[model samples]
Structure formats: C-alpha cells, structure tokens
Target chain A: MKKLVNNPVNVVEEMVEGYVRAHPDYIKQLQSNDRALVNARETKENKVGILIGGGSGHEPGFLGYVGEGMADGVAVGNIFASPSPDPILEVTKAIDKGAGVVYLYGNYAGDVMNFGMAAEMADLEEDIKVGMALATDDVASAPKEEKDKRRGIAGEFFIYKAAGAAADFGYDLEEVVRIAKKANQNTRSMGVGTSPCYLPQTGEPSFEIGDNEMEIGLGHHGEPGIEKGPLETADKIADRLVNDILADIEITKGEEVAVLVNGLGSTPKMDLYIVYRRVEQILSERGIKIYRSYVGDYITSLEMGGCSVTLMKLDKELTDTIDHPVNCPMFVQK
Target chain B: MKKLVNNPVNVVEEMVEGYVRAHPDYIKQLQSNDRALVNARETKENKVGILIGGGSGHEPGFLGYVGEGMADGVAVGNIFASPSPDPILEVTKAIDKGAGVVYLYGNYAGDVMNFGMAAEMADLEEDIKVGMALATDDVASAPKEEKDKRRGIAGEFFIYKAAGAAADFGYDLEEVVRIAKKANQNTRSMGVGTSPCYLPQTGEPSFEIGDNEMEIGLGHHGEPGIEKGPLETADKIADRLVNDILADIEITKGEEVAVLVNGLGSTPKMDLYIVYRRVEQILSERGIKIYRSYVGDYITSLEMGGCSVTLMKLDKELTDTIDHPVNCPMFVQK
Candidate 1:
C-alpha cells in the first residue's frame, strides 16, 4: 500500500497540523498537544463545554463536531489507536469554563480508561467540574441485558447534537451528561462489511471476508462479526440490520425516532439510500414516526466496504437539541 | 458491487426526501421539485442570495453548502448527472429577492448548459438579476492555453466560500461573479485513481484500471486521466499531483496558497494524511505560505479509490471570505 507520508510515526502529527491550519476560524490545536479546541473567539464562558475524544479515522465525529453549538474540544488519538491521557487532560482543561465540562465519547475500552484517567487528572488540577458519557449504540456487541457493553457507532451524532444543545441551553455538567446518556440509551446501531480495510502502519487488512461474502455486526476495529453470509440485496441487508437492532432495542410501535444510514467508508450514497429506503419502509410499516434521517458516512472504518443503520428514539429534549444549530466545517444544523 | 438502492432512478429523489426531512429546520424542498432552499427563517430581503447546483453523489457539495453565509438555495440532480433546467430556474426564482442572485457551480457540460438555460429563463420572466461563474480548477484536464476546459474538483469549496462571502458582504450579482471567477482562476487541482467507480444505474464501472495501476488527473465523472502507471509510494503520488498542479497554475514562490487534499470517495484518512504529509513538505520547501489546508472526502466519485489535491492562491479578499463565518448543517465557519 503506497502512502504519502514521511515517517509512519509522523502521520498523525502532520495530519493534526493540517487539520488545525485548515479550520483556524473554528478550531485550534492546543500548544504542542494532540488536542484541539473551538477557537476561543467562538467559545462561550457560560455554556457547558462539550468535549469528545477517541482514536482518529472517524473524521466528523470527535473533531468535525467542534464548533459553535457542538463540541468545544476534541482530543485525537493515532489512527484506530487511543490518544494518551495527557492530550485528553489538556483538552478537558482548555474547554472548561465556569460551568463545567462534559466528556462525550464512544465506549471503546482504551477510550474509557484513558478518558477516565484524564477526568481524574482535570478534577485534581482545576476547580472545573467534569462528567463523562459512553456511547454504546451497537447492538451486536451486547445482549439486551448487557446493553452497556455494546460498542458505539454512528449514533454518536445524535448524542453530540443533544449534549451540545443541552450545554448551549445552559445545562450543568450533570444535566448534559444525563441528556447525553438518555440519547445513547435510546439509540441502537448495527453494521455489515463487504470488504476489509488495511491499517496504514500494518499495510495488512484488519479482518477478512470472501469476495462474494459479507459480515454483519462488524466492529470498527475490524473484529469478526456475528454473521457471515453471501452478499445480499440492499433490502435484505437492511432487514437484517433493522431486525437485529429493533429486536435489541425493543422499540414500541408508533414511537418517534431518528434514523442514520451510515456508510462504513467505501459504500456509495446510492447504496446508503437504497438501504434507507428499505429501512424507512420497515419502520413505517411498524407505525413508527421518523423524526429525522441521515444518509452518508458519519462514522467510517477507513475505506471498508459496508454500511450501518442507527436508530435513536427521540424525546422532546433529544428532538429539540438535535434540531439546535451547529456550526462546523463538516456539520451544520441550520 | 452490492449497493443499497432500490432502483437507481429513484435514488436521488429518495435521498432528497430523507435529507429535507432530516433537516427541516435548515432546509426545505422546493414545492415537489428536486430543488431545495435554506429555511425561510434564515433569509433576509436585503442580503445577497447565493445559489449553487450540480449533480448528486457529491454529498456535501451544492446541497451541503446551503446555510447562513453560504448558499441560499441548491438544486440537485441524479447521481453524477446534472439537474434539469426547471429545478435550477425554480431555485433561482425562490432565492431571488430584490437583491440579485449569484449562480455558482462546477464547470460540467450538463451543469453549465442547464444552469445557463435557467439563468436566461429567469431574466426573461422577472426583473431579478443573475450572474454565473464556472469552477475550473482541475489542472490535469487541460494545458495552460486550454485551462477553461479543466474540470472543477474540490476547489469548489474555495469558490463557494468566496462567492458566499461576496454575497454576504452585499456585493451585487456582477461583483460576486467577478470574485468567484477570480478564485476559480487562481485555483488548480489534480487527482489519482486507484480504482474506478460504477454508476448505480449502469451497475458497471464507468472506467477500469489494473489492480496494481493508478490513473492520474482523473475527473469526478470517471473521465479518462492524463497518465496511467503502476501505483507508487504515497509521497511519490503526492509529489506528482502537487508538482503538476503547481506547474499548471504557475504557483510562484512565496505566494500564499490554500491546499485541499480531497478523497474521491473510498480513500481513507490514513491514506489522505499520508498524502498531506508529503504535500506539506513539498509546499514548505517551496517557501509557499499555506494559509489553510483541508483533507477529506470533499468531492467524491461514488465509492471510487482515488484522491485529488486542490491549490488556490489566496489574496486578501479571497482569504477574508474563506475565513468568514458560516453556519450551515454541513459546513460551519466558526
């Protein structure tokens, strides 16, 4: 795999430099650290600061959400790898206003451990209040009784939008955490992979599937899925994902929800909409109200060929916050 | 390749339905047509109304730019195909206040023809004034003397930002056209393809390349490229693309430039940053001031394996607009 980098180790640093340089109007890198904050010009002192951290590769998640009415700070890890506690601590400190800071991120093991450590460090160093919420939306990783064990997926968008709005609406740290956790609890996701992806440093696929086969419920780290079968039609594929997710979440009929048909990386928009069409039909038949729908690559696994479906049941608070305005290079509300 | 669409013919309409439903607070579909406008709440009578339009599949382009300080209206077409003239005319009329309207779009045959026809129709029907500018930034499309024949790539972002700023600053239609054209003149892009894309309708690749080979200077529509050779190192790829673009645009030493490392569709960030790493080194060595840089899948070709580099020489006015604040669902300038 021919790559355009100098040294493999420098790829992350250089990429971060370029990202900061590109969006100086919205975000800036903390001094010599792998953490970024919304430009101070746009930071509000009274608003709860929302911070998200995770390994890189999920472009629009951790970093793309940093701007007005979204995330205030983002700490980035190396590709598919966790950032150290120092950067996480730095970001938490930088964004902490008088109100407090909310650390919203996926439920990966490394992320949970590192962010927990960073939260402790920040609590000791400053008078800033801190809270954390884990996004565990993927249904394949856990059973209903073990929902907290599921990995996060593209449903993070809803969590961020809701938590960001809560903060924007002058919610305290605990309030923001409560709302964010509620959004996560109501969200469910499932993914299927048609092709594998290669890690840059390894230059080898993280997982493998046959050319004519696909793996459903694949993890972001390319872990094995629960089901491997022949490539199926979009309708069938959507049915499998929706069935599994609906069964896991046990969404009642006529409930309102937001749907996200996310491309893992290499799936085309046409394909995503195809899956969405089936998803919409299935949900509509169940008398569900789709409050909103998003179709594209929100969270990806490098360039893997796959798509995931995320459904989030919306309450008045989630709906209001999800509709709140966000200004970022990669996302907007209005 | 497997896809998620029900039928290729209905993909665009279905996706548009989902988009408008998802972002009703930010956008609305124009009266049963395939056109969309920024929410009426965001409009002001005296503000210069900026409009953009093009084919679909380029997810964040024409549609994504609609919001405050960006496009006021967007007309969309089928995948990799231009919108019909009626939608373009509808969007123009819908966005045109007493203030003039600016038609900003890529330089594609279908887009130019359709938008041109619509502009003329608008002039014939109402007293509203309108002006159009074509984005021609792909340096690989033609020689210096034939630069006008170049295809627009990711540099459309710069043009959109500049044009949006011009309109935001209350520039008249003619003045907005002038600045947008100037930005296009100062921009250049070049791309490489590891694989070709299949049109959903056709269900076959638009073009083909060998597994070990890549095509350089490929266009967004899967057009034939300037050169085809075995895939090489990421640094070598970046060197080739940057060198060709800089030479084509006659980038001078000490000039300030904004760089965009854009993924065509399926190229991963791991690969994108690898390319950016080398691109930065080459630009730095030339003493060129990189005022800003962007790396992502901006303008895509379905799920193609390729990437493009765009360089725009920045002057005060262009930089100011590029730095100007924008609040939209997909693009936010803080």
Candidate 2:
C-alpha cells in the first residue's frame, strides 16, 4: 500500500514508458503496440529472433533482457498477469528476420495459453515460423515424476541466456529450440517466500502469512507452495533450497554447473551471498564444480521476502552458449 | 526481525566470507585482515590504486564496485558503521602500486575519522602516499552555500567510477583526485524512504514511520530527512526529487547529464521506472539532454522501501571516465 505508483491501473504504461526512455540505446517500444519492447538498435542481421515475454512485476526479466546477444523483443503485461496474444504476435512479427522467432517465457497457464495462441496465429495468419520454449525449472512446485508441471522461477535466467546466445550464434530455429530445451532440462530452482507481494490494482497482499512464518516452494505469482513453516537461519534455508534443487537435477560428482542464488524481491544481496556460501559448501563437499555463479535478484515477486537457488547442470555446449556475450541492461556480458 | 542471518553479531564477518567465496575470481580478503577485500587477480603493473570502502549493509556498494577499471581494494566495516583503521591500512598497503593509493568513500563523521586515521598512518609509518576524495552529493542534506556538508548517497557510484577509470587510464594520483573531486562537484542526489532498515545487532528498524507516510531525503543509514508526509503518487515524488536536485545543480538548456533512479532495497524496479518516467519528462521539457541513464538498485539500505534519483552533470572528461569499461559482478561495462 505504500508503493510509489500513480493511478494503480497505469503502472504498466508508465513503467514501460520510463523503461524505454531510460534505456534508449538498448530498447524501444513498438509503434504498433506500446506493450512490445524491442531492441532499440537492431542490427537487421538474419539471426534467429529471440522473443521473451511475461508478467511485469519481475523487472529486468522478460524486458530488461532484451538487447544485443539476448532477447530481441519482449512483450510486457500487467503486474503478475500475462500479456495477450496480440502483443506477443506483434513482437514476433517485428523481430523476425526471416530466420523465425522463438517465444520464450516462464511456464504459467496464462502465458502458455497466450503465447501458444500467438505462435499459432503467426504460423497460420502471417506465414511466420514461430516456436515456444516454456521454462519449467522450479523443482519445488512438483514432484520429480511431474517435472513438466513445475512452475518456472529464477532458472528462467539461465534458460534465456543460453537460448538467446544460441540465437545470437546464428543457430537455426530448430537448433535454437533444441538449446532452449536443453537449458530448461538441465536447470532446477526452488524458492522460499517469507512475505507476500501486493497486487497494484487492489493495494492488498496476494496472500497472508504469519509474521514469523515462510512458505517453501512458492511460485513467482504468489502461488501456493509445498509447505509453510517458521523462518529458519540462512544456512538451514540454503540447505533446504539447494537440497531440493539437487534432488531434482542429476548433477554428479566432478560435474560442472552454473549456480544462481536469486533474491525473491526484498531479500538483501548480503543474505543472498550468505545463502550462496552454504550452497557452495554443499556442492563443493559433493565434489561438484561450479563453473560460474550469479547471486542477485535476477527474477522476483514484487516486494516478496525470500530467495531461490538455481543449479544448471552444464556441459561444454551449455557452458559455451551461456558464456556467449550478452549486452542487456540487467544481464550484461562482454 | 524477518531476516536470514545466523547471528546478529557475526553478520558482517559471515557476509564478507560469503562475498569473497562467491567472487573468488574478482576479489579476496587480505591475508592479514579478512575485513579488507582486495582484488584477487591483481595486476602487478604500477597503476594508481583506487580503494573504496564504507559500512557493510550497502551490498554492491563498497565491495561490489571493486574490480578491473574500478576500485582496486575495499575495506568493509560493520553495518552502517565505519571500518577501523587497521583494515583500511591493510587494503592501502595491498593495492598500492607505485602510483600510490587513493581513499574514496562517502563523507560521514565516522568514516572521516577512521579513513583519515588510516591515511595519516599510511603516510607517517608505512610511507605509502595516500590521497582522499570524499563524496558529498546528497543535495537535500545541505544548503547550496554548504554543499560540502551534504551526505553522500547514490552519487558515490559516479564518483567512484570516474576516479577508478581515471586511475585505470594511468592517471597520476593528483589527476585521479581531481577527477573524483569533479565528479562529486557535478553529481547531485535525493532519496525518499517509506520504511526503515533494521540493524543486525539491534534487531529493530533504525526509525519508524506511519504506514501511509514517507520521509523525503532520508539518509542511507535511516538518518533524518528534510520532510515527512503522506506517500504521494510516483509522479509527484519524482517531480519533487528531480526539482530539488535540478534547483541545486546549474544544469542549463542543451546540457547533457547522466541519470540514475535507484531503488532503496525493497522498492520494486517497476515503481522506480514509474518515477523515472516523470524525471525524464521534466528534464526533457527543459531541453536538458540525457547523456545516459541507469535505473536500478546500485546502492541500497537493507530492506528499506524507497528510491533515490541521481543526476551527474557530464562534460567530455567526465563522460569518458564514467563510460570506461568496468568488469565487476554488479557494474559490468563492455
């Protein structure tokens, strides 16, 4: 309720306007539909078009990832609400350079339905080749037997990075799709939410929890998680999240992996690193080699207090794809 | 307190441990003193050593900025408290190349006392040449006639970047000092806080406000600000912060400046951008061109809800130095 927003209904429009203006060198909203943000300075090269989209609360995701060597286009929606097919189709049409467009985003019902509809429309109506790569990497949302039913969380960053880099490397549409699938298959994430986020329209929290309690395995959109319990120490939290992710991902001894200790929203970077310290200790003791580690708020729920840990089991291809340079506003690499 | 820390007393040490381990390739603690985080992969070349430090809670601030083309060393203190002279001296000795070491940090009483003592000891005992550049860019903290009395806030980033880049370009200590001074002179910042951050040891917020109120010009350590009022619209807040900053700085028509709308920990990037929308519109209407802009949580108070706006009036020299490539975990520039 203490948020610095104008008419709550106009948060998306104003945020998009400010985002495009702030990063004028990196992104611009489409003239056809202001909801679709594309690379400001397109190279016009015939690389596979990487298009990402989703709800808007998770800043620096979906949109901030649109730039050189990353997503070429991003369709934005209302807070925690998926964009309609119209914006998705517009972004796909605009960024496609005859090399086809791949729709990338988290696995949510509204997003899947809307993006799927956009892909169908692009293929049938516009004669444009379109594909979908849904991220189902949050292991806590489902049992191992129902992996595909798991919701996407912070692991979307790695999936997007690898997929975007593959497209940047001029991989064909099918090859890009393959890389996305591989990234998603190898990535696993789990999160605990200590506090809930408010809906801008209602100015009320999405859910309620005791002040001293936290929800384990909560989804990004405040979805119900596996269990609720009293908040524990950083080490215990790290143990739980890392153990859950490792149980789902087949990272073995001497295997190289990329790790992401992501803050849900309001968790400080200091706590995330403290969590990462335990995660490193856990993995190192298991003889797993960390190729690279990212610790920050890569994805988030609005003002939610928690953290998520992501482990991406890596091979040479996955490593190289992720290592490829990206020049986005948030996830920049040289 | 709803925080993920093990022991309040050991928070700083553990956070430092996690930080060094997480970024082993970029930084490390000095062997003699764990509080001094130095560049892990030091270049033996005799470039001027750029050292920065302050209290702990501001993650990515005092330590996250240490890397290639940035601060070569950082001395960390406990949360919101200045480091003792021992770690400061250790960092100075470790990173000091033949060109000498420069001490850069915010202008606060405790920091001045500690870092000043360190500089004196380095000169009198160790014979290592040391200079100091204090950041005093918080416009709301002082009157125009006494700008030097203002507290440093997010503007510390620009000052650090310019000074570090100058040193990386092999500038002499005097020139680097000049650049740092110039960056500070040209930069101005203002912030509002909706909630207070808790001190780890105290296990309570530094200050308290009504749920519907906010403090304008709140200091990073939860110090008193200029005014307290009802939480206003994002646009209104943006107008107030921007107008105050512009009035203090002599930016005229056709002048170009870099803008930074930074979140104070818990505020979402969505609201920051919403604030930036009005900031950009106001400056544009006045014909002041934006050279470049950065909007995110570059510096933060742990779990504080608010945002800060920083404007750095740029010239050719300042622009080049600010744009210089930096390879740090948080502030990476290609």
Report the number of the highest-DockQ candidate: 2
Mind giving the per-residue lDDT tens digits that candidate 2 earns over B213-331?
A: 99999999988999999999998999999999988988999999999998989898889889999999999999999998888889999989999999999999999997899898777
Residue A252 CA displacement from its true place in model 1, Å = 4.8
Docking class of 2: high
TM-score of chain B of 2: 0.98
lDDT of each: 0.81, 0.89
lDDT of candidate 2 at residue A12, scale 0 to 100: 92
Off by over 4 Å in 2: none
Least well predicted 10-residue stretch by lDDT in candidate 2 chain B:
B39-48
lDDT for model 2, please.
Answer: 0.89
Error of 1 at A161 (Å): 3.7
User: What does candidate 1's lDDT look like per residue over B226-304, in tens digits?
Assistant: 9999888778999999999877767778889988898887887656866877788899899988887777777787788
